[model samples]
Target chain A: MIAILNAYRYRMLIPVNRTTRVLAGLTAALLLALVWAAASGALGISLWEVLRGQEDPFSVQVWWQLRLPRLLLGVAVGAMLAGSGAAMQGLFRNPLADPTLLGLASGAGLFVALWIVFFQDSGAGSLYGQFAAGFLGALCVCLIVFGIAKRQGGGSAAVMTLLLAGLAINTLAGAGGGVLAFIASDEQLRQLSLWGMGTLTNALWRTTALALVLIAAALWLLMRSARELDLLQLGEATAHAAGLDASRLKHRVVVATSLGVGLCVALTGVIGFLGLLVPHCLRLWLGPSHRLLLPASMLGGALLLVVADTLARTIAAPAEIPVGLLTSLLGGPYFLYLLMRRNRAC
Target chain B: MLTLHQAGLTNTPAIAPLDGTIRPGELLAIVGPNGAGKSTLLSMLSGFRSAEQGELHLDGKPLRAWPITELANRRALVAQQELPGFDWQTNELLSLGSNPSKSLVAALLDDLDITHLAKRSVLSLSGGERQRVMIARGACQLLSRCSPTAKEGGILLLDEPTSALDIGQQQRLMRQLRSWATQHHMAIVCVLHDLNLASTYADRVWLLHQGQRIDHGLPNQVLNPATIAKIYAAELQRIEGGTHGKPLLALAP
Candidate 1:
């Protein structure tokens, strides 16, 4: 028995060691990206000099007021989106499931657009108002998709029903946003279009703080469900037989993903594909165990966004491309490639 | 032990009320024609579906009343043709949802004849191989939680467990199941299509026709050729006297 246990312990160490190594690597890369993003903007401000107070006062101000909050917001939004994506995929038991694909982001964007059109001048455009609108939109869409899935009787059929529901919600939300855009004034149009394009330029200290706290809470909830998510991959009935409260798990994941993805869309304006791309790639690297996948996806996402946002700002200096455009540009082709490969395999 | 008192489902693939007691150290086979509600009956037995007419009791308490986790500790179900949603190593799949000892996991893999497939991804396994892996997982779920001093190992419910297996694999699996029932004092209920395998391995057999259990008794008494042929609506020849006088059934060519 002792010998058998020792062998098992040694066998278990392989995955644990790989998890530690991968997480450590991701953390180091995230720190490097943070420093790099902080340093390379419109104004070249070295992080070391900013810390030492040797940079000019104006450079320090730019670093603190403009760059720091944006970078922090980028980290929070990216982590939340990717973590929520990983959790969502696990909950639905489909690798293709994503917050954006499931219409959560578009729903949130529509509500934020509504807030911008009607409530902007009414002093309801505060962070709280935007978050509430976005959260409600996401929650509503999530419940609808979940309801449709439940009605379909939940098997492979439910997965297809979920995706179809997402498609319908996405179309409806897009049309609503277009209507909102059509009626807006020129100034409001510019704000709406820029927000729709998804930039971190509007990142403020207060919004950044709010995004961090809420994203952290959502991510914590998702991570707490890691084991249950793993069990769910066995299919719902089998998972329930294994002692999981399947309905409760579904509710928790639905709420967490809504909160996380909604807050991200509200703050960052529908940053496309970070949720889909980060978790999908990390699953290939670390396998599908959520105990490791969730945190790895979170760190990987933060790193990707920090690096991508830095490029978005610096690549065309003096004017910035929306980071959303950059991620979509990269993620869209990869998504097609994944679909092609899956088709070929089939 | 699992006791069913007029338990049945009213769903589309309905089952008439069934009253039966499945005891530890016994392997009970539920054999029926396709669309005969065999799997539905298994689901009711596993407590995945509530009995519309009556109740199921696991140990002494109502099966539905037992907390899910505690019930999981007492029972495990292996469904038909389940494909895992993600790629998991064979051993990882075996130990999922339960913390079985290394020796127990190894033993299950060996018993299932898939020890060599332990490190391979479950997605890479053939259909028969994956079926065995799922059965081991079900066994692990029960045996790991079973207390040493407990009177019986928990119930294991299987739905068409041998549907994907070849002849050799089917024989090995059935033998292993019988061994587990005898050694671990586990009550096992299997929905099988092959009546001969049931007759050979199962201590008792329940023959179903059109959602109702028409007959259940010792294999020899219940699986007699005349009733099986009538219920199955197929020509069958019963070869008399083999291996302790158990009936050997074959289709009429």
Candidate 2:
């Protein structure tokens, strides 16, 4: 593992600087979070027991069947959320842009509600249908918000209009999901509620693997556009005048963000505030250069979500709270603090 | 030489079709009344906008045929307005051009008298400071394309570079740009609202009125009161043979 990491040390897209040191620190934090999460769950399997190869059937099942998949899913979902947030922030050149704030999560949730109420079936095809519908719904909301923002002239007012549009869509999607819940049968309603309050308890190895692959693909696409994103901070006309095709860059970022956020919501329901805070905090420390920001945010998000998920399951002792609830419970105040700080600075 | 043969936009004929050539080792000031297409002309020369009517040739090659990166290496533009979202340091912002070169960046900072502001956040700069930094960035961008031992001959397009600058900084910037052009055989095209500054430094002057070319010649021939009144529609008195041996115009109050 160290050898693999060492290979990556020299192959980073950006030059090695203080930001690289910050990324290394984030990686260490993520590793620590993984170990803490593996040990501190409801089943109470010690890290030492797993490391020492003690193979009691119950502990072995808890270790292999339960903790591992949940942690793996956390890593995938967290990385996707944070990476997408970083990309969205870069695309809009606004620090406040994120999947949850932009209605992507609720959009996906509304479609998932539709799948649960109308298309619920005990079959593999039905499950895939939910994922596809969720993906399409997320993409649709993203495009709608983008279209509205662009129509408002895409000037200094673009960010304001985007946030307002996102708020309206989130309210609409919430109302739609609520209506679906009102009509759902008892069993379908229970499933929909459980999905709404996100948890990694339902993670399977196959789905975890797929989510990881999708997150990695999205991160790769976002990272490829890092240099252009940096230039775009100078504004569109300047970026274009400096030889970048600004419109093409914006298009590519939008498509990549939709795919990334879509897969994340489909995988983990609505993991609110993870996307917003991970990149915003990292940008506060590392500055707005996307080259370092994207990678560091992925690691930071994985660390934050894993730690939050661990607390979620362990704090309530076996009767676990939703990981999404834990994230918002923690991240909401932090986001408010950021907004207040921005106001103070202004 | 960069030659434009009746090059102009057709969609918004705000700029009439015009012909001109920008030669190496010359500083050409484009002076005109408001809305007379000075900015449009600068946009065309910098290849930011394509002219529908005629051809623009660079080194005997068509302008549109040049790849973006290739064109970027050969030229740089300092726009009239800058609105960056981040608090990037001046040096960092300057490095975002096609080429990022440490030596070139350092030399530009020193030459443009912005060396002290190198580490300062661009967000914290005053308007004049930002304008100087932008010009320095453009110069560094042009210098980045030069071989270490070769003298670079790059085109610089400055659209109202002096608007935000104080009188002292403006004079200093123009003097340095003039010397730099002569020393490096660089071709420069600047749009100036101040007619005296145009006459004082420009090797030649191109005057436009209502998007049409009214005059193109040496500063003396272009800045006389008759032509100034004809285009600007203001009564102006001229003081000839200033310290720079060029005409200076003032309102006849």
| A1-346 per-residue lDDT for model 1 (tens digits) | 9999999988756656777888878998999999888889888788999999999999999899889999999898888889998998898778888988889999999998998888876453476888888998899888887777668864666777787888888899999999998999898899888788888988989788878898899999999999899988887767778888888888888888898888888888988889899999999978889999999999999999999999999999988999999999999899889879977986
Task: For residue B161, give model 2's deviation from the true position in Å.
Answer: 1.1
Task: Return the clash pairs for model 1, or none.
Answer: none
The sequence of per-residue lDDT tens digits that candidate 2 reaches over residues A21-52 is 78777888899889878888777677787778
Write one digit per residue (lDDT tens) for candidate 2, span B1-253. Answer: 7998988777664567788888878999999898888888787888778778889998788989988767877777887767676677898888886566677788888888899999998888999899898888777777776555645478988989899988899899999999879887789889999998988899999998877788999988988999898788999998877865777889999
DockQ of all models, two decimals each: 0.71, 0.51
The lDDT for every candidate, in the order shown, is 0.89, 0.82
Where is model 2 more than 4 Å wrong at Cα? A1-16, A118-122, A153-155, A344-346, B12-14, B147-152, B209-214
lDDT of 1 by residue, B169-192 (tens): 999999999999999999999999
Where model 1 places Cα greater than 4 Å from the true spot, the runs are A1-16, A151-164
